[model samples]
Target chain A: MTKKQTCIFLIIVAAVIAALITGIVLTDGLYERDATIQETMQDVVLHERDKISLFGLAVNPGLISAFIVTGVILVFAAIVRIFVIPKFKLIPGKFQMLLEQAVGAFGGLARSNSPHKNGFLGAYIFAAGAYIFIGTLFELVGVPAVTAAGECVILPAPLSDINGAITLGCLSYLVILSGGIAANRLRGAGRTLKEFSLPVSMSFRMFGALLSGALVTELVYSYLALSFVLPVIVGVLFTVLHAIIQAYVLTMLTSLFYGEVSEPYVKKPKKQREKKVSSKTEVVQ
Target chain B: MPLQLAAVPLNIDWQQILLHLLNFVILFAGLWLLLYKPVRSFMQKRREHYEKMDADAEKKQAEAEKARAEYEEKLAGAEQEIASQRRAAELQAEEYGARQRREAEELAKSILAEARADAARIRAQAEKDARADVAAIVTDAVEKLALKESASTAYDQFLAAVDAQSAASKKPAKGARTEKDHD
Candidate 1:
């Protein structure tokens, strides 16, 4: 931008910030009940009022957020599949290049990790990575939904919930176990069985990491004075950081374990075994 | 039974877990069908296309190289043929020149021998004519002495008689040459 344009842009940003502060001050006076630090912290931890009914069953905010993220992904996927994908050229444009890079990254991850059986692994990791990344960022929208207790609450990150995290973690472990079985049969299952605590560890790790961000944002918001500008920075910073970190960590772990279990087994020939035995006997003698 | 942790409220609901699992499975299916599979296949096709183009280009280059080699071989063969033909033509020309020189030498030798024979025949004819003139002069002197003329006058008479006899011998030879032509 030119000097004049930059000055105009800064003026516009200042105006927007002024308008936002005025709006916040005006909105703050209308609250009927004040949210205390203890109650807010308890709500963040226990999700005491973040539940809603879905098909007559009580579901947490994470499930609602999962559906929202799923819907968003599917809709966007449909748009690309219908409109943009057909128009992709050999010399790719920006959007096409971005999509290709994303797909290529995951595909390369699979191929490098599981060279022998990468077709399914590539698809699986791509799905898992997309779900984690998109679901983590879903909370940034802060879409309001009515809780079962008739209180309105903003949807949180899907994996911040214990059950959702466990689901993905166990699913990834199951995928790894299947990979092992497909590659080495009983031996593959035995190998996966050795890492029995993998699912619980993976799930709890994601839940803790994601919850820390939510808890910190809740703590920041619990203070009425600090809730204004601080929550924006702290909330965005924590959410984005958790999103990236969790996505990479889970996918990396999944691919690593999948590749490990899916590795093809090589058996020694009978003659080689006999030769080794003879060699050992000769050394002993 | 769900184990409760101290201080933290934990709800481990199997129903919620199943629901979340179902949701993930559906999302995976949708994304796989819509995004991952098509994009990957398209990329794979593009890779295969470029590979095929590269292979075709290599084949064309190989063919061009083969054709160039054949052309060079033909060019070399043509040069060798021209050289061989030139050598043969030079050998024929040399043989012809040698034959011409030999014929010229033989003709020159025959011409020289013919000239030597013609000189010998002319020399023999001149000697015969000289001998006839001397014999005629001697007879004429004898006739002048028998007639008792003075000695000096007799000598003069022999000279004149010799001149007449020489003239007579030339006329008869001319007459003999004409008679031979008439015959």
Candidate 2:
């Protein structure tokens, strides 16, 4: 063989041997390490414990995950701002193109739906959507975290918590209300008030969707038969699907309702001709 | 109760609500500065640059078109001037030719009249000279005839005298009388 081909072949062989040795050393005579995953989950009896206290309130597992998710989003935002934003060209790079497409899609959604074209709703929806999608996926990362009762469990999706869902739902409702009021003043408030249960419905939807995914993964992990290869697949599929679907459902509903309530109120002529014709017909009959 | 607890997935937690609400507020501000503002400004600047370039190209094209039109008009005007000049030259040549013909005709007529006058004078002079020579010749011939007749008469008279003297010696006196009676 040629000298370069021999060298590459030797390098690949060496890498495989080194990986096998390292795996053996790490296992330390345990050939089946993954088998204990189901047993550990069974013995632990996993449950969310609200223990972290501040100002007479208990910060639950969902809040802890929410804090971590928020930090992740903030750091990502900072990196894109500092390094990526300044280097954006007219013909965008891949990362820049993705960002532009994302923002443009959401902005276009807002513009197409909104009557007066509120700017903050689009920005707010983008942030909220990112939070919901990424927060859902964050649970799949399996970050070891302690609950208030000092019991350890994997991180949870923030929206799986009813409180976080309520907050986001109410916030979205407030944004829609503000948009309507800004576009149509007192009439806008009346329109928004007409849909009062919107927040409750939105919150329950988000909470239910993420909670179901979590429970299913939890159940799968706690069992021995399905825990081997199935938990990973099930967890990832449910998380990703729920993340994408819930994000879309929330953003679509907000923008659509925002569009509806924010429409300008035009006074109609008091049905003069139609009412007179109807009245004359009724009298003749 | 155990199955019911297992079935329930959500419960109220006030702290997460407030925390998430605050987190969302921070996230919204951050995303606005990082994503929306800068990208939009870049796009705006690019659009304006393209529009400016288009306007500049259009302006230059219009100017060039105007210059070509002016050049074509000037060329047409020069062609018209050249045609006018050529026609004027032709007319000038025709007038010059007419003037030369008139001069030539006048000169020929005067020369012919002068030659006719000269021939008439020369003919009259020749006639006068011939008439003088004929008169002189006639006068000389008349004088010579008279002289000859006179001499013959004298000679006859002398001979008659001699004959008379001799008749006295013979009969010469009768011949002298006969000679005087000659008609």
Candidate 3:
């Protein structure tokens, strides 16, 4: 930044810190609650009373967050499809380059793994990767919704919930199974069936990784002293890191298994060739 | 038999799982239609267009090379034809020069033989005329001797006749000069 901009930034920071101190002093007992650490922990672990009803059914906060992320993604996709994509030039601009890179990365992944049958596999991985990465980042938005008990709660990352993780993991396995079936028919299905532990492993891995970030962030917020600036670093670091690592891990594993199961079956050589080989040896002798 | 299980930590709701699955499916379909398919098709089309342009350029270059080779081949053939034509003309010119020289030599030999024949005939005619003149002169001298009884006067008349015969022989020399001009 320039000298003037740096001075302005420093002044804004000081003013915001002053305002926070004043607010803390003024609102000291305004929002006080007589809840124990165990109760807070129970609320974090099981949000039974914090569920929001969607279409006459109670859904977790993470589900609402998932819907928000999905809606945003869909709207963004629509905009790109209708307006941005048509303007893409042969010589790409910055936005076009980014879009092409994202699409090409997934395409290259699918092609490298399953060269023979990667059309559907490429599309699946692209969708799955987008969902995981963006869904993880959705938690940072801190959009609050009122629960069934009229208590406002921040919607967490979607994959932090077991339902979302299990759904994605099983879906990935289904894609792999479909790839196998499409390529090698019954034999392909059998190959997928041979690795029955894939869905469970993939689900729990995603759930654990994402939940650890949520839990750590919760733990920081639970303590009043550490809630000031530490949650920012911890929350951002954990969410972003888990997003990248989990997205990569799941997509890579799915493509690998899909490729293995979809490999073309090679037939054995005929008996006539072996006989011809022996006859040639006899002739040589 | 009913078995009562202890507290399970997981809130595994089948409905929520199903809803999440449904949400992902919708997202996948929407993205496929909106983003992935169209973008990939555009790239594939661009690649094909450039490939076609490259092929056309290569084809034109090959045609140009073929045309250049043909032109060079024709030029070489034309050069060989020109050389052969020049050689034929030179050989024809030499033959014409040799034939002209041979004809000139034969004509000169015939002209020399004709001139020799003309000289020989003129000499023979001169010899005959001189013999006749001498005979007449001798007869006249004999008559004078008989008439005047003087030998000296007859001898003077004979000398004059010999001088006339010598002057007449010079006419054949003029005829030989005409023959030299004809040669």
Candidate 4:
């Protein structure tokens, strides 16, 4: 669809989802009971049930429902594209236009990297993978679903634990692995697979470090249990750090991929010399 | 205290945690398939469209610049032509003025020569007329003197002759009368 249409669609979908999540959080007894129980426990949970609201929509909130809903929507869109539209030989009209524009951009990026070879597949894979990774992280954090409930979402229970730290590290490693694979596939001459791995590794390392720091800080401060100000401060600090790390990781990976794809076309002097010598010998003969 | 602490058993829901984790993974996959891909694609398309427009605009700008230079060159050529024409006109005017001046000088010279010739003819005629008049006057004066001298001489001679004749006749008459008186 046209950009405006797509945006509108997203907004409408988001609104509907938000409304649904809000209804679920407010009307459903599960989230409220869970919050009360957790409060009674006074355990090592990183966030208080009372302080968290879904953008102020929920009296008490759970983000799991929102994540599930958004996930369903995504899967639904993919299914529609694959089955209904593709089978009928029907174009998505404005939606196709939007898709084409995206394709062209990725195509351009690919072309820039590998003028000789097609980089479209690589770009597509990378873009798709990145989205999946970010979405997964967001789901894990329960942000989108939390936003739906109008609550200030925090990382869920196990993620704040020591075990959670290890889980996140494993997830980071998976992301790095995927990134490395994509880089390798896209890589051209003059670039080693190792070169691509560097950025992927760095991204994971940085993510790990940030997560570690945040977890340690939360454990030490017990800020989530304190007054509202302390929690806000800690949240802001963690978010900023997280955002910086994420941005760095994304940028480095993109650069590495671009470099890998474009490297082959750059001719070495020895090749030039060989060609020149062959041509001269031909002329002389 | 030990008995009271031991009496509270821990209740952990591993199933719920696993379900949530599974849900999170599924949600992430779904989002990647749908929203993120499309949004990114849209942005990329927008970027490409703008880049194409920019390149086209740059090409048009270069063409406009070339056209302007060509127009300026033509204008310079026209200016040069006008300048050359002006010089030619000036030269023509100079030549025309010189021809007019030369014609005027030649006319003046011819006029002066005619005037000089006319003056000389008049002077010559006047001199000729004056010479004839002087000759006539001299002749008239000479004739008048000659006539006066001749008249005086003729008068003197006639008087002398008459005196002689009277003298002779008187002597005769006296002699004859005396003879007659004597007779």
Candidate 5:
């Protein structure tokens, strides 16, 4: 599949999962009655055992909140991309330097495989795939939702929270699509899907490992009556560790791909000498 | 367990719902306009700039390699030319040495011939001078012997008698002796 299609698929899957979880959590208390309503309406009502199911089909507040939060995050990401990034001139600063190192490392990998002509584009496509894959993972984990608010909505099974899922899904899809399209257009035929796939696959594997580790750690933490601060600290530490692992995996995979692609183009002295000899013989003949 | 069916009258809040929907739409639209577009564009621009730089660097590297190859080729050619020139100079020096050697040999041969000619001429001249001296000595000796023998013979005696008579009448009979000596 193209990078765009893959990104869309990931985003859609993540959003659906998140929305289902949120919807279940939100509707958990829908059937519960308020004790105050029974006491106040006892004298006024003719039937004492009657009950009411008000707001039966009303949209869950949590779902709306989650959607609002996602929208806000999108806006924030946009602002950073357009205004903050441009203002800071991220190309010359530490971030830009870091990006350059990343690009160089990936480019080297591509060059190793094919040729110098293809390495640059190959690295770019690789980076785009990775960024989108990680973004989808983060979105599914509800990191952006958590950042927006401390709490999120939960969903029940059997009923799909279509609106919540589709909205967030579309947003995630757009972000990934934009990145992928830009990469493809910029790199053109020079970029190879295989080159990009290596990093993407490696990154996903690393992310899965890190996530498993985090889950294990959290499970251990759950056993302890740890303070709020301790849990926060542990969570932050795990996140940082996960990020580091993912970054390393990305770098290693990119370098490997670049190396594989560029090997053919690198001129060997022995080969050049042989060529020269052959040409001379031909000339003489 | 008895299933208790219950129904209650619901109060609808259309205004509140409408207000919330409006709020959501406005907030979403506003945020989308303000934040998402700019950030994405900036990221795209950043990515483009880096890619362009990468391509430029590769092109520059290729150009440098081409130039280096050209320089090495030129240098090799120059070295070969210099080697040929050196070989030619060596051959020229060899030819010059050979010519000088030939000239020296010719000069030495001419000198030797001249010396031999001079010795031969000197020997011939000495032999000629010795023969002439011997011939002159022999002629002188023969002439001396002939005169002495003839004087001892008859003719020598007659010449002696005439010489004695002329010597005896030489003082008083000069006029008369001229006629008598003629008879």
Candidate 6:
């Protein structure tokens, strides 16, 4: 930049910093006088109820965030299908290549995992992976909203909510059970029934992973000493890490279990039971 | 773990769970329709179109190659036929030329033989005529001489000269008499 441009940029940055400091000081004074906030900013961290009143019904913050993320995803998919997908050439453009690679990878993973080869699993996994990744990073956009208590709060990631985690976990388990049943019939139900607590374990794992990031960010923001640069650093790091790790973890677990349950059990006669064991070793190899 | 779960507000909200499930299902359906189906269809069509075009081009190339090979084979056959016909024609022409040459040689030989015979006959006739003219001139000279001198004395002189000349031409007269006898 030229000297004049550099000077102007520094001036604008200084003005923005001054405005932020003034705003924070004013808000601090107002909160000190208000008895409602005198509980020493107890809600700055994890709160019991972050309820949002939508259409005269009490909805959780996680639910609204999910709705928004889903809407964004839908609009994005529509735009790509209309404006981008039609323009796909025999030789792919960057956006077209990115979409193909993403779908191909997820589909390839499912196909490679399932011994019985469920063709639909790939698409389902792609959908699930996309939702998890996007929903985890949804709150990083800092979408501000007003709660029923007239307080300003940014909506957190949808999966950070226990309810969202439970929904995803249950859905994955159902998908696995369906794959097993499709491949093995009644035997598939028996196999799936044996892993009855899978949904609970998966839900807790996801919920805990996402909530840890949120809680850390909140803890950073809650302390006056750490609210400035520290919160920004902690929040971005935690959010990005959780987005990638949680997305991979959920997708991996779902695909693995789906693959396991989808394989048909081979029938061996009594005389060939030991022979089946030898064959099993060869199959494993 | 139980204490941690209790610490967070993880109450089972059926309404929220139901809504979230509905949202995920919609997302899945939307992605499948918008992204997977269209991309797969486009790829399938493109692959089939290219494959069909390649097959057509290959088929045309094979046809053209077959036609060219047939044409080459036919051309080679025609060339071989033409070569054989030319050889036969050349051999016939050579045979005709040799026959004509032989006929010409035989005809030339007969004509030369006839010409030689005619020249010899004409030369003999001229020689005979010259000899007769000389004899007649000689008799006339003798008669004129008798008129100028005594007849008996001139006749005696001519007889004596004839006798002397006869003696000198005896070998030629003998060969002529033999040839006349043979004729």
Top model number, TM-score: 1
| Model 4 spans > 4 angstroms off | A1-236, A239-285, B1-102, B120-183
TM-score of 6: 0.72
Q: Which candidate should be chosen as best, given DockQ against the real structure?
A: 1
Q: Residue B72 of candidate 2: its Cα lDDT?
A: 100
lDDT of 5: 0.46
CA lDDT of each prediction against the hidden true structure: 0.85, 0.75, 0.86, 0.49, 0.46, 0.79
Off by over 4 Å in 2: A1-57, A228-232, A270-284, B1-9, B51-183
Each prediction's DockQ?
0.56, 0.32, 0.48, 0.05, 0.05, 0.47
CAPRI-style quality class for the chain A–B interface of candidate 3: acceptable
Give Cα distance to truth, residue A72, candidate 1, Å. 0.7
Determine the C-alpha RMSD for candidate 3 after optimal superposition of all C-alphas: 7.4
Q: Give residue B146's error in model 5 in angstroms.
A: 21
Give the lDDT of residue B178 in candidate 6: 61
- Misplaced by over 4 Å in model 1 are A1-26, A32-35, A268-285, B1-9, B71-76, B95-183
Per model, kept true contacts as a fraction are: 0.78, 0.68, 0.68, 0.11, 0.12, 0.71
Q: Chain A of candidate 4 scores what in TM-score?
A: 0.38
- As a TM-score, model 4 comes out at 0.37
The residue ranges of model 6 lying beyond 4 angstroms of the native Cα positions read A1-47, A227-233, A269-271, A274-285, B1-9, B49-183
Poorest stretch of ten by lDDT in candidate 1 chain A: A29-38
Worst 10 residues of 5 chain A by lDDT: A153-162
TM-score of 3: 0.73
Per-residue error for A187 in candidate 1, Å, reads: 1.1
**Residue A142 lDDT in candidate 6:** 88
True contacts reproduced, candidate 5 = 0.12
State the C-alpha RMSD over the true interface residues for candidate 6, after superposing those residues. 2.0
Interface RMSD of 4: 7.5
Ranking by lDDT: 3, 1, 6, 2, 4, 5
